[model samples]
Target: MGATPVQAAEDGRVNRDKLRELIGRMTLEEKVGQLFVMRVYGHSATAPDQVDIDHNLEEIGVRSAAELIAKYHVGGIIYFAWAHNTRDPHQIADLSNGIQKSGLQQTTPVPLLISTDQEHGIVCRVGKPATLMPGAMALGAGGSTSDARRAAKIAGAELAAVGIRQNYAPVADVNVNPANPVIGVRSFGADPQAVAELVAAQVKGYQSGGVAATSKHFPGHGDTATDSHTGIPYIHHTREQWQELDAPPFEAAIAAGIDSIMTAHIVVPALDAAEDPATLSPPILTGILREQLGYDGVVVTDSLGMQGVRTKYGDDRVPVLALKAGVDQLLNPPDLAVAWNAVLAAVRGGELTEARLDESILRILELKARRGLFKQPYVTHKGVDRVVGTRSHLASADRIAEATTTLLVNEGGALPLSRRRQPNLLVVGADPASPSGSTGPPTTVLAKALTELGFTATALSTGTAPTAAKIDEAVAAASGKDAVIVGTYNVAAGSAQSTLVSRLAATGVPVVTVAIRNPYDVAQLSGQKATLAAYSWTDVELRAAARVIAGKAEPEGRLPVPVQRADDPTRTLYPIGYGLSY
Candidate 1:
């Protein structure tokens, strides 16, 4: 007896037809299951935190992966391998397979969607480790959309090889505010048009390479000074502000056929005065995202447990409210049962309609089917060792690191420090921590490269009080030497290096300040002979900076942001598009 087409369809992975058929057959409960995306940790119990009596306290750890899927029939899973948990990429792969297997055990043959936040090649879950590409700002510094696309391709290929079908990345927020914490490194740059183009390329790169890309923090998180994860942050800008800066990249991404849009928990008072928070606000998600911007793809939320929502809505009810607000999937809710029950309660109480649940479920199923989850024989037993941190990928990462380094300032031929009988070099900056946490390279990777070029180098560690006297001593040490390089690490969050930069630049020995964080610091060091902004402390930037200083490489890096005059507090520390070549 030959098999019927329906039977063959049933055996194969989910496609559009299969998804439609499954949706038609699903009960209300099944439909609701597809709307919930939960965080999953593998079999290990003692993870994320010291085996707290309550395991799911931290964002990284969760209740057993099996329990969540088996009980709730979750639509998707977001993977994050925090430090405490088993960091093995293969272990994560095994866990991913385990999730699918658990999903298949359900009465309905729905495949679970697996995702991760592999925004940069450094942030990936699978494949041989590649170089941590410079954050968006570095690509902006490189002054090319192609660099952004190349970065996305590397990140996508690495993630997809490990079965991460969805990547919640390419943060589309503009980095306009220097005081803005948590977003400086993540955003591409401050320029709206440049950010839009680069983000669109990133989306294209991820999707084309098989990993679904998500343009994040819609409306925008750019202008705000607060961190959404910490509290209820609001973008005080008006509708005009949003239309010009915050809304551009999102529009570009949607136009580029982005697979998903993740809503930030930010509130834009200009858009919706009442119920301003975007995550649970209907006006923002439905009215603006769906109706105005015309984004028809899946809408996912930032972690529900973040204080932006949780502190405001409490842990129990936020998930259900998010669904009512039109978010198709929730990211990392507090409790799966609590969230699921809340959804059920909402459905029973008429707060959430079955029709609404079906809409989200159908979309999820469509996405899964689109991913070939229903038709294919999913083999989760991928030996992760072969794919994770492969040599070829690592080499590419090195190249990206090298190419993305931008030289912000060089004056009076002060750079390209002498290689033979080299001038005395003083290095100060990032902890020389290797991947193994061993003191790898001091003074950023670029400083290490300078050492290799034969510069006699001295590293002055930036202590709590980075004083002018210590800098003067270093300058005195190199009294007859050709140059003094002060590598400052004050850009990224958790920095205490700004004092050192100011102190060192004060000593007049042809001082050059290398800023690997914000380019604004260039204005702070106008008294110095030269200032450089590499935007990040990644190894690649380190090497590029070394080459540029040693005169081995030309200073081709243009300022991605404005360079403020060092003395101008009223003016931007650095105006956008300010860079120097000597």
Candidate 2:
């Protein structure tokens, strides 16, 4: 039987009766606004008609964020660094408070759900002085649910302190393809059960830290070769394989009572023969996620502007179809007027009934109440920095990063080098700058770390493809050096880093190549003196790698995913749990 009003209120902590009456009183335009989670341009809630980096008056057709809320009655706002919404902790809190103030001042006064993609490791939108934990795959390598939970709790707590209530995090993709460009290091691991356990733990951890947790890219975006942001990738998993590989993490999420699930924009031809993205397919989102998975919580579509959703449907039809497919929140449509009016028109044209929207609106309102936003949504600006990047939080992040140091190959006690023996070290190789615009490459960070540890380390920033001159320069630099370390990022068997490593190994200076991004490069650099997988090039990870080199810390991480054979992608060079200890 369905829950009674009192039972429902107890279960979801929402005043269902009040929300229902409010919905009955809502105008058609206001009801339509409750369905969208839009993006606005600025750092301030209300601003003058001026132009700046983030405040483009021409683009938004409004002065500030408050104007967007008043003009369109958007239910939520998502922040991006490019939008200049997160300049710092205090600013973010002020902006969030301002947005909530305007949202509550409306005629129908609904509090906005403020959100960001604070996925922590490579995908983090909120940068330092916020504590940045080692991301998902690093936790997979650490092989501890407690560690994963603790890291997530810290990250979620910092976001909450700043009034960001929703974080699109704990990516449950279960990456199995070594060649998958987008989700390689973002996923937990290739093992479905392992990923499931970590995903469930992270869900509880994030919620306990005071925000809603979203397990995203539903129905398994793990094996796709194409990124959904640029092109729609098809997953050819048979029904049986999908059951084995793709279904477990989401099932675990639902079992954990996750607050929301975001739909992937890919198509699984086996699940539904139609070529429509899962964002618009009834069979996939409703038949599978709603009925089979038994998830009645808020269902959000991935960004509508992504190429994955734009392939089949026009801009007008995308939002309406997604709503028809049972998605509660339409996220980030490029054209606000077109998508918003299309959804409004669909309800008026009788293609969509108001009852369908009420189902979603009630769930959204219930979520806000469950999060305790209705009572106290504002955050003091001064309190933001006290909780964001505290010493304990930074220490916890360091512990997680140090634990993810996986030593792939250590020949004859090659690692744990003595500072006295390896005093003069040459650090060179591809140090790709962070896509998120972090400080210099891993090479520079490692050199700086070693110097801090009382080692005279010389850094040579060789591009990934070392030119003839750079190669010769690195080789000359390696001559007579006590030891040499090279950082490689996602190098294939015959790739440029592979060629560079072969040349450096000939120097007989104990060359160690650390896999900074993709650990699959292990198969390519197997002949080095030693290889370590730090999983990411973030400063914390590199500093941990440096400590291990200086005999200060132990390498505790193992390969989360199997290392694919360089020549043949079907086989593995090393198993998932393979890592050497010094």
Model 2 CA RMSD to the hidden true structure, in angstroms: 3.6
Q: Which sections of candidate 2 miss by over 4 Å? A: 1-12, 48-58, 435-439
TM-score of every prediction relative to native = 0.86, 0.95
Best by TM-score: 2
lDDT of 2 at 217: 83
Tens-digit lDDT string for candidate 2 (1-582): 111122224444677888788778778888898888877766778752245424445555566788888888888999888777887888888888889888878887778889888776678778778888887888899999998899888888889898888888879898999889789989999999999999999998898888899998888899988999999999999989999999999999999989989999999998888868989989889999999999999988899999999989899999999999889999989888889999999999999999999999998888777776776778885677678989999999888888888998989989977786548989998877573435567788899999898788999988888887898899999988888899998887678778788888887788888888888888887468889998888888888899988889999998889987777777778999999887
Error of 1 at 144 (Å): 1.9
C-alpha local distance difference test of each model: 0.67, 0.85
Provide the lDDT at 434 for model 1.
31
Mark the regions of model 1 whose C-alpha exceeds 4 Å error after superposition: 1-14, 24-30, 42-63, 83-86, 121-128, 377-392, 430-446, 456-460, 463-484, 491-499, 505-510, 566-574
